[model samples]
Target: MSSLPINPPPRLLMGPGPINADPRVLRAMSAQLIGQYDPAMTDYMTETQALYRQVWATTNEATLLVDGTSRAGIEAAIVSLVKPGDRVLVPVFGRFGHLLVEIAERAGADVHTIETEWGQVFPVSVIANAIARVKPRLLAVVYGDTATTMNQPLDELGEICARHGALFYTDATASLGGNDFAMDAWGLDAATAGLQKCLSGPSGSAPISLSERAVAVIRGRTKVEAGIALETDEASPDVIRSNYFDLGQILDYWGPRRLNHHTEATSMLYGARECARIILAEGRQAVIDRHALAGLAMLAGVQGLGLQVFGDVTHKMNNVVAVEIPAGIDGDRARAALLADFGVEIGTSFGPLAGRVWRIGTMGYNARKDAVLTTLAALENVLRRGGVRAGTSGAGVDAALEVYEG
Candidate 1:
């Protein structure tokens, strides 16, 4: 332990999520611990839900936090919403849609997928046609997949889900803060998110929102205790099989009457609240604009340096960009050098795209001129060391600067 360094390098995280945390969120988390049932903590919980609604651009009464990482929220929504024999339609453009199907299968749901290639977005009609054909009870998709660094279109699909009487759920873990998203307007019935991605915070809290229809469905399936009938009311019509991921019980705790569940992670709740508050303070639209501009700058810089992006350019995610690793440059060696020499981190692609592409992100507080410029420069130097063409070292930075200047 004594050999461990007391201080660490100042790292510039330009990768997918768990980006730099906001100082306010850190300080808020640093406050002295309080009992989970403390009135002050619950007050923060209530306020946190409200702030998240603003961040989600929704008035959903059921918006609240789950006590685990972003995956926890995704599981809660899937397990709670889909029961045995119910049909779930997942449009699998990337890893997350696969995850949805895998979880739904465990939850006893009949899963169906309309899968696309890794880098492609399904046409609105593709999803609409799938829903019309499958007539599923639930539709699950990811808003932004870090694996492919792509944002799926929602507006048309939301309307399609509404027409089919199916609930629409999205995992916005990688896009929540930086992208333009409107839960209600998009006709989304449910959505889950995390503070670690674009919110620029840690990974413990899972923020979720459910529409009234979603609430009624879960309320209809609530479970009852064997001997507590005398003390309480009838067994809930909606009995969720999994006690841990049940949203009904979760909503009960966050609602007016604070029901007992797990001791809410107080520091995480404060961290999430501060994350939302900071976004609120900045104005959601402005935050999105910053991500978009920064993304554009990076895109321009990468293109200027003669790199080919991996996927659909027009429908790209605002905070993440994926580019081919370029021929003759040792991908792993370049990434290691960039980190060792520059104290910067950019992500590698996943699954089929792994080793073929590199993913760089401009998300949350890290979506700025310096972050973009620094990442571009570091990458350029790394590529140069790996035998890339001359004169390309600052090409990316110069192109990105041109975007800001304009």
Candidate 2:
């Protein structure tokens, strides 16, 4: 079989995730690699943790990366924290909500998920009631779900968890850098995120932070090694359950003593660090404001073009907009034309809502007026080509221009 070379097309990623990475992050990743235990490399690790502290809005000394995707960090936090037969309550308002329940269950927790309609979020009353009734040991939820472009209202829920004495955990993979997230202020015990989304970096690293309370719980379960505990003899446990993912020893390894865990993904660490650096340098509130304004532009443009929106507008994710696929417009065909003809890549929905919604993401470096306007224009053209008598011509671009100018 004739195989093709690795060269690929340059298409704007206006999709749900794996959005366009910033050029600075890419450059950082391209720099020289080093040994995991090297002094210079460990310096980067420390700096990376510090940078993530700013991103996550936490002073957690244990803030660090797990060497995998977003799900890995979620699993590490859930499995490591919850003991067998622990009662965990999960809120299922979107696809990621289901993920929280699944992860907790697999870790031997007795998981009970309270589900609402896919496009909606759990009311604070419902969450409080669930907690009062179930009295779960932990509460796992998602901040934003890319599947439906919805952001759960977490402030009140976090307060409820605290009042009920249940540790709160969130997967902020799809919205961490793209929107507002206050780990400490919002009373989160543990939170997980990936570099692939708004962080505008590669997918190999998961940034995670644990509260002091969370650390106490995990530390309470630790079994001291008999050999290692003795001063005269030294031996580590059998690679910590799963060597690559174990975060217990990882904390010590990354801590002041410079112990050894898995060989951290050096390139990805560079990218993740640079990602947080950019966000911190830009300022967290400013970043969130930028995403808000630019996202609103995209939303208005899509609406101006006569495309319907999916989900409640009030609770939608700041960086991703979900628009309904109109009649007579072949969703797949329009997506193809947008990519091949216009060099843009918007997203499609999944599961029960498949073939109905087109997810347009304004994330990372791409969450700007220019990118938003360009995508709106390209999508409008594709819609016109696909037998839709819509798109206010250049109106979408005009509105975006106003946002950019202001």
Which one is best on lDDT? 1
Q: What is the TM-score of each candidate against the true structure?
A: 0.95, 0.93
Taken over the whole model, the C-alpha lDDT of each candidate is: 0.87, 0.85
Please give, for residues 77-119, the per-residue lDDT of candidate 1 as tens digits: 9888987889999898888888888999988888999888998
Give the local distance difference test score of model 1: 0.87
Model 2, residue 381: displacement in angstroms?
0.8
lDDT, candidate 2, equals 0.85
Candidate 2 residue runs with Cα over 4 Å from true position: 1-5, 224-242
lDDT of 2 at 201: 86
Q: How far does residue 365 in candidate 2 sit from its true spot (Å)?
A: 1.1
